[model samples]
Target: MLHVNSRTALLNNAAFSLDVPAKIENGTTYVPARVFAEAFGGTALWSEQERKATITIGLQQVFIHTEPHKHWRMSQERINVLNEKINEATDLSSYSQIRTHFRPYFTDSFINKIIYSNGIKNNAILTKKGRYYLQ
Candidate 1:
């Protein structure tokens, strides 16, 4: 476990020292990935050229990019447009209507949910279908 603004971490009741303390910014907790990975018996490799970190634990590998996504500006614009639409909507009765108006900004899976599923609630049918799809 990690405490905010603290450089000490505890694992199995053992204290581990850190070069930098964990911090919270904009309601998000930020910890040294290298220290956490090493504490958990994993290895973290940094790529300066790619601006990314490759973390490996046993047979699994996870990649984390440090830079913003390529489409960040475009996504922000889309979100602004969606927010404007939401703010302007005064007569919208149902979520389906709002979703229909915002369909162009949604992904295929989200569109499928709006088209196929009844709402956001996960009933037994959706749960079974989700499990089957995962399998």
Candidate 2:
């Protein structure tokens, strides 16, 4: 057996191989740009204006610049109305309303038991995967 230290051995043993990369930052691993470019069907470029250090990506470009008007805001009156409706909805128990709506669905035995056994006014009983309150 022979013990050999080689760069080829290290590269072969490495978890990943470097190919031309998508992104590169200074003081960090410089990825191969060409591999990602081919993979994504795009191109990477170097710019002299950017001092050649910054990697400029995406050659075929679509730059749509549009400034939306910021004046459209919900009014205080609208906010107040929304808040009032929410409060009205969440203020009371839905069980009473459910009972009133589906009173015909409850049997006489269950209603009699509910009436005698503890104040089950707002108490709900699960029936057929739906909820019904004791009237």
Candidate 3:
């Protein structure tokens, strides 16, 4: 179950605050596309040529048509922090920031599975650039 209040939402006891508020139209709730996607351990991609946005999670993918006239603010700070850390450090534990800020990402079951099954070994990961990431 999902619980939403204004710009904040909670799913599986993981809470997120978005820049935009959720909408209630006809008593139905609507959240931004990006916010909802990431909450479920998904990554979104936008294509200029196709005017579409795609969210990928595990082996599943969802596509949404984007309209040029409409304005949407998408925030990727959650992913950005993880990427920046992985890019800069040889170990995930080397991340200097407070862990609570990144709790959602770290505690995500899907990401843990990926880390444990594919990208990580012996508390280390080899990035595509051949850099070592320590857990």
In the range 7-123, model 2's lDDT, one tens digit per residue, is: 121223443333323233464543344333434556545444443332234555422233433455555555455334333333234446533432453455554444454324443
Q: Record all residue pairs in model 1 with backbone atoms less than 3 Å apart, i.e. clashing.
A: none
Candidate ranking (lDDT, best to worst): 1, 3, 2
Candidate 1 least-lDDT 10 residues: 126-135
TM-score of 2: 0.25
Segments in model 1 whose C-alpha atoms lie over 4 Å from true places: 68-135
Q: How many residue pairs clash in each candidate?
A: 0, 6, 2
Alpha carbon deviation, residue 113, candidate 2 (Å):
34
Please, what is the TM-score per model?
A: 0.42, 0.25, 0.39
Question: Model 3: which residue pairs collide?
Answer: 90-134, 91-134
Write the residue-wise lDDT of candidate 1 on 75-96 in tens digits.
4444466445434343344555
lDDT over C-alpha atoms for residue 120 of model 2: 48
Q: Local distance difference test, per candidate?
A: 0.66, 0.39, 0.61
Residue 50's lDDT in candidate 3: 92
Best by lDDT: 1
Please tell me which predicted candidate would have the highest TM-score against the true structure: 1
lDDT digits (tens) for residues 52-116 of candidate 3 = 98988878999999766654442455345566544433344544452444455455564455444
